[model samples]
Structures are given as C-alpha cells and as structure tokens.
Target: MRYFALATDYDGTLAADGRVTKDTLTALKQLRASGRKLILVTGRELDDLLQVFEQIDLFDYVVAENGALLYCPASRQEKLLGEPAPTEFIKALRDRQVNPLSVGRVIVATWHPQETAVLETIRDLGLELQVIFNKGAVMVLPSGINKAAGLAAALDEMKLSPHNVVGVGDAENDHAFLSVCECSVAVANALPMLKERVDFVTDSSRGDGVIELIDKLIASDLSELDEQLQRHNILLGTKKDNSEVNIQPSGSSILLAGTSGGGKSTLATAVLERIAEQKYQFCIIDPEGDYENFEGAVVLGDAERSPRLTEVLDLLEKPYENVVVNLLGIAVEDRPAFFAELLPALLELRSRTGRPHWIVVDEAHHLMPASWNPASLTLPQQLEGMMLITVHPDRVAAAGLSLINTIVTVGNSPQENIKAFCEALGDCPPQIAPQTLETGEALAWFRGKQTEPFCFRIAPGHRERRRHARKYAEGELGEDKSFYFQGSQGKLNLRAQNLILFIQIAEGVDDETWLYHLQRGDYSRWFRQAIKDESLAEEAEEIEQNNRTSAHESRDAIKGAIAQHYTLPA
Candidate 1:
C-alpha cells in the first residue's frame, strides 16, 4: 500500500460543534478495518477532548495540546511529550489579567486579542517557549515542541514513517504536522493560506471532508497521489545552471551508468545516503561487495558464505532496518536465477506494506544480462523505488532497461554512455553537449520528465567508501607475472606472488634491492600491469621519482601504498 496511515486533525477537520457525526465515525471505523492506522492531532487538551467527544477510541493515537502529549486510546495511557507549563509563566499570565486562560500538561492557551500579553509574559519570564495561533485561539508550547514533534513520537511508537502517512488539517497550527507528512491535505473550509500550502483540498467541509478523504484512501490507497508527488520530490543535486534536480520517490526507476573507475559508485552512495537519512528502508544488492560500509545498513553474507533470503526478508520487515545482500559467494552465472526468486517475495512484501522503500542493485548487468528474458522474472508493471547501477547499460536485460525512467551517467564519456543506454532501449538519444564532469559529478536525464540532460555535482556520501582489498592481497598470481626481487650479492630469483608476499619481501630486502627496483620504474610497471590500477601506479611512480628520498624511505613508501590499497587476510 502506498499510504499506511491517515493523520487527521480534530476541531475544524473531523469534528463539528465539538462533536463527530455518526457518518464520520462509521467512515473512521471502515478506514481502520482497511488495515490503516488513524492518528488524531489536535490543539485541545486531553481532558477537554475526552469530555467533548465520547468516540475518542476510534483513533489509535492522539497527539493533544498541540504536540504536548501523546495518548493511546486502547491502553488509555498518556505520555507527556514536553515539559510542564512553568508555574512562574502561568502566574505571570494570570497577573496580566489574561482572562479565560486554560492550562494542560504542557500547554497554556487562550483566545485571540491576548497573544500580545502572552508574548510579553513569556519574554518577561525568559522562558524558551513559542506561541501558536489557530483561528481565534493562541497556544504556548516548549520551543521545539509542536504538532510535528508529537506526530513523530506517535509514528515512532507505531513503527511507521512519515513518508507512508497522509496528514489532513484545516487551520494554521495544523501546518507543522501536515508539512512533515508525505501528502498534505486540507478541508474545503480551511483558511486560504492553509489550503494553498497543502497538496489537496477536500470538496467537502469538516467531518464530511474527512469522510471523503477516508473513502478515497480505502478505495485506491491514494493511488491518484502518484501525480502529485512532485511536491514531495527529493532534490538529487543542483544543475550547471544552478537549477535543482529532483526525482519522485514513487513509481520511478533510476539507472546509474558509467565505466569502471568512474564515479558511478560514488554517485550511488550519495543518493543512498540521502535515502537512509530520510528514514526510508532500502535493500542493496551488492554483486562486488561495494556497499557493505554504508552506515545504518546491515551487511549480510561475505566472501565465504551466501546470504539467506529468509534473513534478508526478515530484516527488511522492520521499517527502519536496511540490508546489504552481498553476492560474493554466489556464482556469477546463477545471480539472475537467485534474483528471480527474490524479486517476487520483495514485491509481495511491498504490496502488503510500503516497506523496503528502495531496492538498489549494484552491478545490475550481472543479474539482468542482455540474454535474459523479461518474462523470466517477476516485475511490477510500475517499477517504484528501484535503482540499477551498471558499467554497461546495454548489457542489462531489455526488461530491466524498459522500466528505467531516469538515467545518471558519470565518467569522461558521459554522452557516449547515455547514447549507449538510449540505443539499448531502441530510442533516439537526445542531443546533449559533451561536458567534462569532475570526480563527483554526472549528467542526469529524466526520460519521464522529458527535459534536456543537465550536469549535477553529486553530493558526498555519509559513509566512507569501502575499497576492495581481497583482490590485491590474496588473489593468486602466476610466477612469471609476480614481482621479482634481486639482492646486492646476486639475483635471488625470488618472486612475490601476491601483495602480501610483496610487502613482506620489500620489507626484508636490503636497501640496494629496493633502490634498484625504484630506479628502474619496476614498481610502477608491476602495479599498472598486474593490478590494473592507474591511480595506485601513479602514486608509486611519484615515490620513485622523488630524488630527495632515500632507498629505505622509498621502500617504506612503496610498502605503505600496498598496505593501504590491500587488506591482509586474518
């Protein structure tokens, strides 16, 4: 389901004359029966609200006193979310003759024309408090406490994300929580400013408007909201012209394409970091173990073992937990079959609960090869919250490519990569000027938006990128391809087979042997040809060419480079 909860206001939204109609109550029950949660956010005190309405139990949770308290109707448990109203502040208000004053667990409220006195009292008392106005009423709360904070606490207890909630209100104070919701709604009778700031306005007023929204939610799960998601779109980055680049989180697919050694993984890391920071659950399909270092995501499996599908699914069921499924132990050829089985389960889970909001497939070409058939795997008609990363987009299965609505290309030849992806889809590539992107930059093309491709500097990732070490440290190498060390006395004819052995030999050998290799450019040559890493080789070359360095210093520098690039096996 797209929306899992409906958070509505009480006074001017669901209640008229301080009472809920039988028809509105019936609608609320029907909404709960549809497996959706109900949250009542109101500025009224719990005692006052209970006295006015007898059907308060219809709501699972109530945030009262304008975010000062959280109440669970079933358990009849009330928790104060903020500090109590200060005695001095309350006394000062009374001294100022603030008539008809009311006090709750953490809120002090009164009608309009008294806000000036309330502000003066708060200032005189030097209290960290804020005043909120709702129509003719004025409420004072702790500085950081508001309807949004209260709703957050309620949702946290319910294990739900604001991204899965739709909030409705009809007044000024309601803006705080409504703005935080995935979809903001307002009743037709709401204030002009309130209605203008929301995504949708109901055709009816008060309880009838709420009933109208509930009916629509139960019928379609708010599927019509897909078009209005632009208001909730996330900023990817800024373009060259300083325009903001954005993407909708629902019913969209993004493909990151580039050659090896480019910033493809870096760009993916930035995007994932934002997704994680936003509290959206994501599952990363890591083919080369690239994303295990990401913060807040649990890494499953390793080089020695394959991840169990059951464990992955279990972890993702929790709304806040994320998982990285490492495919190191699984055979490369069998990845598609494994993913074929996993996709159906994931889709089923998403259908039942809008969880595991995103699925990022790194090295996507391996799992969805060009020869693979679309019908071979279970895929939703609309691919929402899916991201595919690949070095070669043309190598991915046609079915997978067909679902992609956005393309982000990195590297020196971004235009060529974009062209290749377009050709793979059998569509003419749009004309884009060739531009050189820096280390953390890319060209973004939103096919669905049909806008011209623009350049955007990708944001840096939160977690430090994990560099692969096993490939250089323990990988087997042929004798002829190994690094040979010659001593001063004679040619030892000794070969270091791997990075670990090379480091050991370099450390033990005499200064002459090290200098000989350095002067001959042998270290740089070996790094380039054997490891196929130009950047590492360049650093080694820089150390060799430094005339100010001694033979021992050079050897130490070379060893440091090897150790930094490769991890020693335990």
Candidate 2:
C-alpha cells in the first residue's frame, strides 16, 4: 500500500491518437478495484477530453489544460486551477496571425511554429507567462502552473501525499508532474531525455506501456523495484565496511533500545531530522514531553493539558505537518489506554494516505507493556513501518516486540539489551561481543538476516540540542562541571550551579570579577564542555573576543544567548 494512487498522462501515454484502448480501460478498471485512486494529467482542454473520451468516469480526478484546470468525473465539476488566458495576450497573438490558435479556460495552445510568434507577443506585451512544449504542441499558461501544480492540488484535496503516488507519462511536458511523484515511469515511446530521468521505462510503447505499469503496480505495489529507488531511503550510517546503511522507507520496524541518559534521544533526534528532510511526516508519541520545542515538529500537548485525538487528526490532514503527541498531562496509569485508542486511529489514517509515514512511540514499554493484553489493544500483525524507542524492549507487549526485526542498541551494554529482547521473544540471541558504545555509536542487528551485530557511527542531528537542558537549567551539576565565579586574585568563591544561578551571579558580580571570567573564556568553556551546548558556546566565544564592551554589556549578551536557547525562571 505504499502507492495509494496512480497519476498518468493522457494523449501520448494513456491514449494513442487521442483515444484509449479497451484493454487499457480494463486495466484502469482493475486498478481502481484495488482501492487505488486514478488521476489523469493531460495537455488537452476539458471539453476536448470529455468529447473524445467517454470513459472519463473511470478517473477520480482529471488535470486538464496542461495543469491549468481540474475536472472531477464523478461530480462533473470543473475547477480552474489557473487564471483564464489573458485577453490582452490572446489579442496580441491574433494580431501576429499565429494561426490555428486554441484557447481553454487558462491555457492558449498552438503548434510548434507558432511558438516563435507567441514568444514575441508575450515579450512585447510584457506578460508573465511560460511556454510549455508537448511534442509539437506549444501551450502558454501562468508561470508556475503546470501538471505538477494541478496534480498537487488534486492530492491536497484528496488528503494524499505525493510520496504515495506513482506517476507515468511521455514527452517533455510530462517531466514536471512525474518528478513530483514517489515513483516516475516513462513509457517506451516517451522522449529519450524523459526516459533517461525516470525510475523505469516500460518495454511496451503507448497504452500498452501504461498497462504494463499498472500490472506491475497491482502485482506487487512494485516491491521488486524497491532496491532501485534508493533516493528515498533514510540514511542511518555506514557499516564497518564503510558502506552506507539506511532504513527503507517502508517495511522497517525499528526498536531503538538503551538505558536512561545513554544518548538515545540524540540518535532519535538525528533520525527524526532525516525523516522530516525527506518530506515524510512523522508523529512522535512522547509520554514524558521531552520533545517540546523540537525543530520541524508541532507539539500538541503540554504538562497542563492532554492533547485531544481529534486535534491530532485534524492537524495531520494537512500532510506536510509533523506532530508530537505529548502524554505528560495524562496520568501514567491511563497512558496505555490512551495509546490503545490512538494507535488504531493513526493506522487507519495511514491506510488511506500512506502517512504520517512514521509513527514514533517514545517510552514504548509504558504504552504497550508486557502485562497488557495486546488482543484488547487490537494490535495488527503488520504495519508498513514505525519506530519504537524504549529502555526496556522486553517490558513491551509481545506483539509489539515481535514486530521489531531490526534492533538498534545504544547504551553501556549493547549485548545485554539484545539478549533481553531475544529472550523475551523466545529466540536465541545473536552472538554480539561485549562492547561499550561511545557517543553517536550503536550496535545494529537485523534478526535472521545478519550473522552478528555490527557497530556503526550514528549520524548527527541537524539541530544541536542542549542535552539534558532542563537538568542543566534547574538541577545541580557536579562540582567540577558547575561554573564558579572565582574571579581575578581568587577573591570570590561564588558558585553558579545552574544556568539560572550563572546568569544571576553574572549580573551581580563585581565588574572586575565579571571581566576576569570573560577575558579568561571560562563562560564559553563551561558552556561547551559542561552544558554540551555548542551553539551557546559559539555565541559566548564571539562576545568574549570583543572585550571593548563594558562588563554589563557582555553579561547581558551572554545572558541573552542562554535565554534564547533555554527556558529559564521568571
């Protein structure tokens, strides 16, 4: 179900000589029966398409006029995707005697030779328009309006993502829309340039090529071709052989297990950032509210209130949004029951839209504990893909744990975590050497696939998180890590245990004492090595280098940097 829709070009791709064959029609019908929607993208006008093709009802949506208009067959409603052909531009074309001109709701078209005249007329008129070449046909439309725009509009209306679509076409004009689809196919008769760029080229030309694509799509959802489409893979890291490793867009149920304070969140953040980069939506089920203010995501609930399921569903309907479902407001005893209700709803949404592509369950054991009956939870035998992050995989329900064929261990003892997981599932654990993983390192074992677990360096997150930022902001740091205001001549023994205390002390310390610490680079050093916040340290270093500023100004600048990064007390 990775591809929930097929968008195909008309004329050269779906029909030959402006007509669809009986066999092609049959294929379309068969494909529609598979619960997949069909979109017809064409350069032809809506009126011409309706007159020539009596089987228009077979399509869910028709993008006509080279992306300037949308037609729904069931409702027989026509929506203008772009403005109508400019009257001044049309008059200028006629004045130039560009013969054989045909005008639609938004597109004005003519044969190849007329394009020279059309271009001149647009130039003279100072009109903002673009010329698209479809075989010999030249069409003019508003800039930025094309088959891709029309198709995107249709998908938006349908609540579908372009990532769940397979598009097929021929000729140069087909390039725009096809490029936006998850998988692009060029028919054998397609232009050579187009064939070179597409994911696959059908052996059969014309309508037969479309039928070939359809058969393959229905047969396996094109799973056999997955390996060839590596552009969509989520890069995790490289293995010992220095070969790149990735999580397939679908079919990978990963369990990221580690102990508390073991750099699990760091790895998880990196993976989440990559997922968002690929335009795949993800929903994080965060029980502890750790993801507040995470980049590229919308936090749904906070400590004071539980997020409503309806709100989550409504926000996800937009397709581009990532959500964090924080459960801290919900009582711990009620969290599992809340998740039991939420997972099914999310699965149902994914069934239709093929997104939010990844569902990240944080503290997975708490939500699907071993003590709970998975039958009552209505856990499915398979999900396209999801990520489960927890400290104890064995504590999670058996059904949930069984789905984790790919295990990634990130902690002091990788072998112990893997053994606990395998023993819980009643399977022999793979022989992994006892090794303590370093920061940004993890042991990965694909059960029944790899002979042994392999260690790989984890990719860094795009945004630098102030790790344990809450702790560093409010809780006590070790005496060594804590900042001390022992300024010049060691006159003051003031200790600033946290960021809150550090800022307050910086504001009140003697001017000479503050200047001493600023000149010594102690503030930047502690921020980098102790708080482990690189961005903050960079800002502090910049302020420290410019010593002309008064101590009050430097203190304010340093305080501002910290406040911008971390939430502090009022």
Candidate 3:
C-alpha cells in the first residue's frame, strides 16, 4: 500500500531540544511537496510547541499534549480530546504545596513528591484521569491520553488509517503511534528501546534520518505497485488488497455466458480492453464482425478477404487489438478445421509473445467445439490468458470451461450453466442468480473458496464500448454494412487523423509538437506517431467521440447509400 501519511514525534524525534534543524525542516517540507500528509505527535503544550516550531503550518496536523489534544497547523485551530481538570482537584493540589502548571488543553503537570494530594484527589473523584511520567515531568490528563491516543484522534479527524501511515520517533511517548503504523521507523540516535521495537532503524540521525526513510520509500516503487494493485482489486482481485481473488487453478477458460442481446459482446469487449490496457496483446475471434472497431485492434477476416493463419499469427506477435478472425460467412463444417489450424498458431504466438493478456473467442460454440481438446491448443502456462464468449455456456467444451480465472455471467438463465461449470470443476460456489442484470451488470465469480461472488456494475467509463454495441445493434448507427464503407470514402478520415493526433498526445508528444508534423504534411509519420502514443486519456476520449459521431453518421449514410444504389427489379 502507498504510505499516504507520516506520524512523527516532535521533541527528541524530529527536533532536538524542541527546535527542528534546518535540514529536518527541509526534509519535512520535501515530504509535503511529495503530497504526503505530515502529522506531528508531541508532548509539548500546543502553544509551546507552536512557539518552538514557529513555522507550524509545515505540518498538516498536530497531536499535542501527548495524546490529549489535536491541532490543525494550517487553521491554527486546536481541539481538546478530554475535559479540563476539575477546579477542586486543582485547589487540592495547591493546598498540598504542589505547584500545578497548566500545560496544553486538558493537561496539567506537576513535580512528583508535592503532587501526592492532586493524585489522591483525582482518585477520590472516581475519575479516569492518570498522571504519566515523561523524564522529570509528571503529566496528567484523562486516562489513556498518550501520544498514540493523540495521534489516533488526529488521524480520525483526517480520515487516515494507521495502516496507510509510517511513524518515526525516538522517545517513549512516541511508542503508541509507532506501534500502530504499518511501518514504524526510528532514527539512529533514537533510544535503543524504541529502535528495537520499530520496523526499520535508519542509519542517519535526526533530519537526515527522516530523509533517508523517505528516499527509501520512494525508491521501493510502492506508489506504482499500489496503483496496479488497485486495478487488480477492481478487475480480478478482491476489493481490498488484503482480500485476495481466488482464481480456481483448474479453470482453463472463462466463458462469458449470457443470452443473445444481453450485452454479452460488450462484456467480452470490456475484458479484452482491460487486457489491452495492461499491454497484453489479444486475438479476438469475431464471427459476427463485432470487435473489429476496437482501437489498436486488427480485423483478420471480412467479406473481402480472410487473413491466413500465418498472417494472423504475425499480427498477434506484434501487440494489436480486435485481431478478429471473422468466421461468419464460412461454412459451419469449415470452422473447426480453420480453428484447429488457427489454435496451434495462436498457441505458438502466445509462446512467442510471452502470451497476450488474453485470447478471446466470441461465438464460442460455433468456432471452438466442445469436443476439441483444449490441450492441443494450450500454450505454455507462462503465456495463457483465455476467454470464451458464448450464449450457451453448456455448449462449450466442459474441459475448456474449467479453466476460468474469472467468470462473468450476464443474463438470468445462467444458473444452470454456472452450476454445470462448478460441477465440472468440482466444489464450485453455487451460482447466484442475478435478479436483473440490466445491460452493464454482471456476476463475477472469483477463484477462491472464502470469497463470495460480487454483482457489480462495470463502471460507466469502462462501458462506452459496450454502449456502442447496443447502438450498433439498434440501427441508431448505420447497419453493419455501413461501417465497412463509413471509412471507405475517407469521410471518417478526420477521425483517423484525430485518432493519430490523439495517439501522439498519448505517446508524450504535446499537441504543438504533433501539429508541427501535421503542418509538414507528414501523414504517414503522423499515423505512425499516433499508433505508438501511450496516453490512454486523450486516445479514449477521442476514440469515444469519434466512434459516437462518425460511426453514427457513417452508419446512416452507408445504409441510405446502399438502399439508393441497390434497388431490385421491380
């Protein structure tokens, strides 16, 4: 997990003699610059601490009076965590010749021997307050008020979890906050007791020590790793990192089971899109000619010409998307033979490219027969990511169905198919029948016994392609025939141009930089630049808009044009 916040004791830890050194101050400022939350846990009174650390606003928040009071450095506001000392108790301490000093909120300190009367009076009042010894100072506050408690209170106000924090300290009072953090660090000059109990002991002392810790953290690559893990949570893994997704080891393929018109293709597209986002190449068997429009994808077969297996394999070797093997017009008997030849080449390509993120076969029953042995098509385990989309999951090979790492069922009648899938795999969780899976809803079956299947909506951002599928089917856009010609006359040429520009922006080229090439009439270079662009943001937005507008216009025009030209013998 990313360390979102840092909790450090002020006196003796971050600052010696209540004054932070210039180096320590700079290090803290650097941590702030890096977007880390800085919290100071201290035993000093709020105002006194502020006096010592005059640039108080450097800290995001502060825990003062050990753990009894909290303060916001930016607002200069203080919050007392406990009630003030009773007037009677104060009077009693004074009567006993004890010199009671008001420190910070709810905290009163006094010397030990003369403070006996105050202690007795506090106990007599049946209060939970207690006096804690820090060096020579006897500090009194509500019982359980300590540096750790103070830090916890401050953290609550900030909505930060201890698990996302790393505490650094050198003193006894800092122990509470240190022990609770995910990573506890101590400086070299720190007390041996504190250092021994902490998770990491830095070689440097004081300010240099904290900087050393930050340097180590940034070098560990925790930030990037956390980002990927978060995606895993939303996709294949559990919602929280600690909760792992149980992928059934035996499942060789995940069957996207659903009825026709139930967003099966869209859901399948989402899976492949995610795989592609991870830079995994994919080959989608698009029998219905769907998936060809996906960006970065290659269409293998069309009414014009079907690419040879060698051609498809070559394309697969170079990371491309929507690598479609259109088998729609092929005779039914010929599909198996074609797939038989195609599968081995795909398996070889998987071996060559170290496996694309996924191998997606849509209209599975039509292409990959249940009787066909998956073993024959199996790539080495190192390069295997398989996905099958079918209306009838039962019709797909039971053996093939057993290999699913994740099963996304879209329609209502999938209980039986899921049940059969479980039976084939042995001890599969009982299928939870979706009451109503409207368009983007799906039940994702995770791979472990302890985990439960989740019914989640594919986030709207991830569902654009799926929405387009509905538009494609509805004739809201032109019919499928129109898509072929929409780009034919180059009316969609701007889209191609914009798409190339979008890619250039993604590839770290600024608009001004790419515009230079476009102004120079470098069309070929422009497209090349766009194809290798790595920015997902600009590409997705442009592609989304491009498809919506051009695809819509092209669909309408192509349908009208076809009708106008092809009138029959009346």
Question: Best candidate per TM-score, number?
Answer: 2
Clash count (model 1, backbone only): 0
Highest lDDT among the candidates is held by which one?
2
lDDT at residue 115 of model 2 (Cα atoms)? 91
Question: Model 1, stretches more than 4 Å misplaced?
Answer: 86-98, 114-127, 215-231, 236-242, 304-320, 329-345, 370-377, 411-570
Reference-based lDDT, residue 175, model 2: 94
Candidate 1, 5-92: lDDT as tens digits:
9999999899988899999999999999999999999999999999998998988899999999999999999999999988989989
TM-score of each: 0.70, 0.81, 0.41
Clashes of each: 0, 0, 17
Distance from true location, Cα of 269 in model 2, Å: 1.5
Worst 10 residues of 2 by lDDT: 459-468
